[model samples]
Target chain A: MTLCRYWRLDRHPEGNTRFERFLSLHEEACAPLAPGEVRIAVEWLSMDAGTRMWMSPRTDGYQPPLPLGSRMVGLVLGRVIESLDPAYPPGVRVRGFGQWADVATVVPALAGLEVVDETVADPRQHFGALGMNAWTALVGVREVAAVRPGEWLAVSAAAGATGSLACQIGRNLGARVVGIAGGAEKCRFLLDELGVDMAIDYRAEDVSARLSQVPGGVHAFFDNVGGPILDAVLGNMAHYGRVAICGMIAGYDSDVAMPGPAKFDQVLMRRLRIEGFFIPDFLERGAEFLPQLRTWLDEGRLAVRFDETQGLENVPAAYERMLTGRNIGKVIVRL
Target chain B: MTLCRYWRLDRHPEGNTRFERFLSLHEEACAPLAPGEVRIAVEWLSMDAGTRMWMSPRTDGYQPPLPLGSRMVGLVLGRVIESLDPAYPPGVRVRGFGQWADVATVVPALAGLEVVDETVADPRQHFGALGMNAWTALVGVREVAAVRPGEWLAVSAAAGATGSLACQIGRNLGARVVGIAGGAEKCRFLLDELGVDMAIDYRAEDVSARLSQVPGGVHAFFDNVGGPILDAVLGNMAHYGRVAICGMIAGYDSDVAMPGPAKFDQVLMRRLRIEGFFIPDFLERGAEFLPQLRTWLDEGRLAVRFDETQGLENVPAAYERMLTGRNIGKVIVRL
Candidate 1:
């Protein structure tokens, strides 16, 4: 038997996550693989804002709160060490929702684990550009918003994991993409690296004023950081615009309630369609999205950026940095 | 030459429209019907919240403010007394956007006039049940929300013009309907007259509390009156719910700024789709709607409720009452 190290939720988080207090590290003997089960040595864990939501005490939310004394829930890329299933042989790579642990026992039928194609060079890319982030961006821009060619698409948190992919996806769909990022460097990266038409430094300039300067105003908005930015975007939306609310990272850590968009009246005046979506809701559409994403990745049309931390122990610090907007792209903990 | 009396906007209204000062009665010699033109004797004028929006000084809106010193823009049902146009000959009835007047000289090509069928018994029904109100409710409930059968639907302003129609439409689509109205009388009307499953007197009871008691929560919402009620509905919406915003009459007359929905976070948590729409945007679908609406009317499956005023002179008072939620169903001024 091998000892497995994992983090368990000891208590519900208050305001900004006090990870050290709420989560306790524990070590236990890894159970031998049972019939149709695969034992995976976790390689990389994806740290997202959603993890923070699960840690909170709120009973009413998109996701159910993580039960206390249970292993914290997260997505992981792992390599199979032992397996009883013929489909997932030993040494095969897989990705699925698992515990924040060093070793995970996954039942092929019960666990939503799927084998990663051997042809895929980098599995981390699957976590960032070619995975859930890219999938969500595709659903928001293509399926929900139905972005038309020549339309102006504005993406908030444009340098973050999902937002960066959304910017590229917007451009890929023949839209004029405008990226809103925190600093000058991220803005430059969005314009030069991501091939966005315009990059606005939201920290330095007034977003609404910058949007007003655009020829026809924003026809679609892909929002990750909600609150004032959402209000700003609403004010500058063209007639019959669409807004896809993927995440609201700004208010995630705050104890006080976040105020709703002050310019919501614009929704009525401009006839805007604002939709909020979860990635899990569109999992079936992944079959439709993966081929296009892979093609873009192979052709160097899509770029993946990861802010990786060294060990599982450093995940809390990485998560804190991501929540504060210090991290540039996808936050990852490599084991 | 025949004398035609009409109302002209002399000034933009501030707060609740002071019709006596801003709108002045003007009498002028009616222009003779020229080639391609038709003369209409106005029969019924529609008074709506949109008229109040048009009267406001705000330049940034869905439609441009009614041109200063021009006749107040409204929808009117009229009979063509003299005509040079082949389509609109003398004795033919028509429906179109025209000024509040006893007689209107309309160029068939310039005026959006369509000849009304003589087979239709009640032309006033065209302004309410079969016209913009019902059309708006249809687009909101059917197309935007796509309310499925057995879904719980909540409608704001349940006794008002568009709201009452939306309640019936929700039921017609096989949805279990809940209504929000101002007073006990309106609530009673919604239950007894409109066949709503539940009615919440927003003036008395806590709307959010009442909604929480509902099993499975509300699946869709058709909103006409925005403000606190919108916030309340947002809090109680089930996962993947849709909200169709057809109107926001609550804030139409407020001198102060309107506060947005407080439970907007629920929009992201529940993954709700909130869309704002105008009826004219879906005018092309009128062909599909009119036939179904006419059949429903013929079979008495649909009911038309009009709060009819005696004369055009009382239009201002009728409009004031409508804006205050004192009038139920469609408010019409018979000329």
Candidate 2:
């Protein structure tokens, strides 16, 4: 028997998650792998704002809420220690949705496991810049918003993982990229590191006023933090503009219902298109996306940063940091 | 000189338009046709919800607010009585944006005049089913929302001009169409006349409850009324649902600011797409659309109904009736 430590849903979150109160850490003994199953020793777990949403009672079309006392669902990168499946032999690294635990015994078919390439410089990058974050950014910029040359693309949460990658991709697509971040430090990072044309410090400055100064209004908006920021951008949208809704971290913690965008009428007036998408829906295009992402990373055209915490014990704290914008880039727990 | 009676903007509307206070009826001495100009005897006018939006303080990208003392802008079908331009000879029927008047002296270029074909049974059809209304519906269904076979389409204001046409188009495109209208009478017309798969009397039934009975949730929503009705539909949207935002009559006459759709967060959860568009943007495709529409009308695959009021003198009353959902189909004025 193998001892596995994991976090389980203790209670439904009422408002902002008090992770300690909502998640209970527990240890369980794992039985030997059954037929078609593989045992993985998890090395890294992705912590995202979306994790917070999964703890609440299911309200929208997102994945169903975790049942009370169930292991918390998360994306994990692990090495296969024992396997009954030929495709995932022992010693191969794999990535799949699994419980946040040190050891996970998963049926390869049920877990939707994908073998990770060992040749990559940093395997953790697979979970950050080159994984779901990059996939979502590409889908939003290229497929949804269809950012074109000379168009002004504004991205919210520009210093966050998906937002930073989106800014780079937008610029590469020849769009004039403007980033909206929280403070002067993130603003400087957006301008100097990510090379966005303009970075608005949403905390210190009025975003609408700053956007009005842009010669032509924003042609596309990539929204991650939806709320007043989404409303502000809507007010400044150019005619026939498009918005790709990726995440709404701002309202994730609200106990009370969040109000709809006040300036939604502008959607009619400006003839804007707003589309929300999940990365899993476009995973079939991963073969097409991964190679391009690899090339850009090698050429130094794409950059990735991580706000990492050590040990499984800090997973909840890392999630809290991600929700509050306390961490920059992708937040991860190194198991 | 020909004496032409016209309605001009006397003041900006404060709340619900009190036409008597805001519009001034004037008897003007019509000027003779100048070089490249034509004199038209206005015959029919198209009244739509968009007309109300144009009178408001400019908030969106629609046409600029009509300046006080200026003739109200609208679509008119007229017979040319005199012309200096060979392209438009006397007795030729022309359609373009013109003032609400008995006669209008317009330069072909300035008025954006197009000599309309007289072969159709009713030239008035050009101002209703064959005109902007049909064009908006087709674009929303075919181009924006892209309704497909076996999909469930829920349309708000489904008994109104564009909504009714959109329901038919959705059916023609092979989708199961459901309609949301204001009254029992309109709902019957939608089911009996328009051949919609389902019809909900929004005033009498619970829209959300009715929609829940659909085998699959709404795959697409054509929103004409954008308030709580939009919210109700949002609550029941299918995964990857698309919404075409054509009009929002609910807020047109409001004295206070209208709140946004409360259930809009479903937009993110369901990975839905909401696109707002104006018919004018797609007018370039009118050549392709007109022939198809004419064919559909001939085959009885499409039908048009009008809630027409005679005489331009009652234009304001006709408009008021349309805004209140008293009119069941395309509202028109015969002059």
Candidate 3:
């Protein structure tokens, strides 16, 4: 019998940040795969901010919170070791929702398991240019935000995985991009590496004052962090602007739902559209999005900087790093 | 020489309700009409909640708050007695933005001047079925909210002009409607007169509890009074629901803009689309919407109840009554 090491939810967290106290690492003998289940030898764990909601006891979240004593869930990139499902057979590298574990057993359909392409220069690209982040950025900038060429597109959490890709996608679509993030380094990364038209260090800068200086006003916003940042963007939106909410990391950890932007009145005054979109909701259309993303990847237009933490034991710290805006790009655990 | 007695915005308003304090009636000899100007013998002044924003000193409103010392502007229905513009001939009954006075002068272009149908059963219907409120309801319900047949559409401020018409329009579109209003009388009017699928007196009942009882959560929301009312609706929205913001009467009078819904994260949780639309933006499309509204009016599918206040001196009281949700349906002042 093989040993499986994973993080388990001990309790629902209350307060600012208590990743370790509520979640504890545990080891167990790997169980036999259930019918339609596939066991993956996880090579990497994707640290996502959206999963933070599942830790809360809030039933009003996108989906119900993870129950106590359940394995902490997250996206996993790995090679299949054994499988009951014929589709996700052993030896193929796959990427999808799985536990934060060294060995993760998943139901193929529920986990959205799919065999990833092996032809990439790096296997980690499965969690990079061709990953869910890329797909989210593509659909968000193109469809949800409905950003047209020559318009100004502002992205919050601009140095995070999804936001970084979104900034590039906005540029690829010929829209002027403004990336907003915490710290001067992230701003530099946005301006120098991502080549965004403007980069605002939200931690130091007056976001509203900076955004209000945009020529006509921000036409489209791909938002990841919502709160005061949302209000800053809302107040500076041009008439008929659209906001695509990708994540609300600012309020994700709270027991209480976040109060909406203080500048909510601007939605009417500016005749704006605010739409909240979850990537899982668009998973079925991934095949439709992959071609454009692949082209961008081949053209070197979409690049992801992976902040790798060694071992599954470091997963919580990496997740906290990403969530707390300490990481510059995609944070992943090398299991 | 004609003596024009009109309400003048002498100072920017502060506090909750201050209708008479900030605005004072002034009499002056009518000046010669400017080029492209048309003069109307004001018969009716429609009391609109949206105009309350102009009373504040806030610049972030839908339009820059009406200039201090300018005549208070609102929708006026009357006979055109004098005109420099040939399009609006003398004696033609018209409706457009004009000053609150016995003799109101307007520039045809800026005021959205239109020669209304004199063939209607009642001239008040011009401010009802064929009016801006009607147009707002049609665009808000059918277009912005995008309520489909059999879907549950919830309307806030259901007793007021736009919300009242929206309930009927939603029903006419074959959607189930839940009307939320201030008092039992308004709820009764919604259920007994408007025949809405359901009616909730917001003051007496738990709106969130009442809304959560909807089998499938509310699929569309046409919101007028934003605040806790918005939060209640947001928490109960079905996945991919649409919100058409027609007015935020709850927040309009505040010098400081109202805080957004407490349950704002529901936008992302429910994957909702919240859009704000203004009537003036869709005024040009009125001709396209008129046939349908007119047909509804003719078929008796649409009806209006006017809460009329006699004389121009009572305009402030009428405006206060409507703003405070003390009046039902359309509130109007006869000049």
Top-TM-score candidate index: 3
TM-scores for candidates 1 onward, in order: 0.95, 0.97, 0.98
**Clash list (residue pairs), candidate 2:** none
Better of 2 and 3 by DockQ: 3
lDDT of 3 at B178: 99
lDDT-based ranking: 3, 2, 1
Across A112-196, the per-residue lDDT of candidate 1 in tens digits comes to: 6878776888889879767888898889888777789999999999998888999988998899999999999999889889999
- Model 3, A53-143: lDDT tens digits are 9999999998998999999999999999999999988999999899999999999889998899888888888888898898888888899
For model 3, name the residue pairs that clash: none
| TM-score of the first chain alone, every candidate | 0.94, 0.96, 0.98
- For model 2, how does the per-residue alpha-carbon lDDT over A215-309 read when each residue is reduced to its tens digit? 87999999998899999998899988999999888878764346789888878888999998877777767778998888888788889888889
Q: Could you give the CAPRI-style class of model 2?
A: medium
Query: What iRMS does model 2 reach?
Result: 1.5
Better of 1 and 3 by DockQ: 3
Cα misplacement distance, residue A167 of candidate 3 (Å): 0.7
Model 3 regions lying over 4 Å from their true place: A14-18, B15-18
Docking class of 1: medium
Quick one: ranking by DockQ, best first? 3, 2, 1
Per-residue error (Å), model 3, residue B186: 1.1
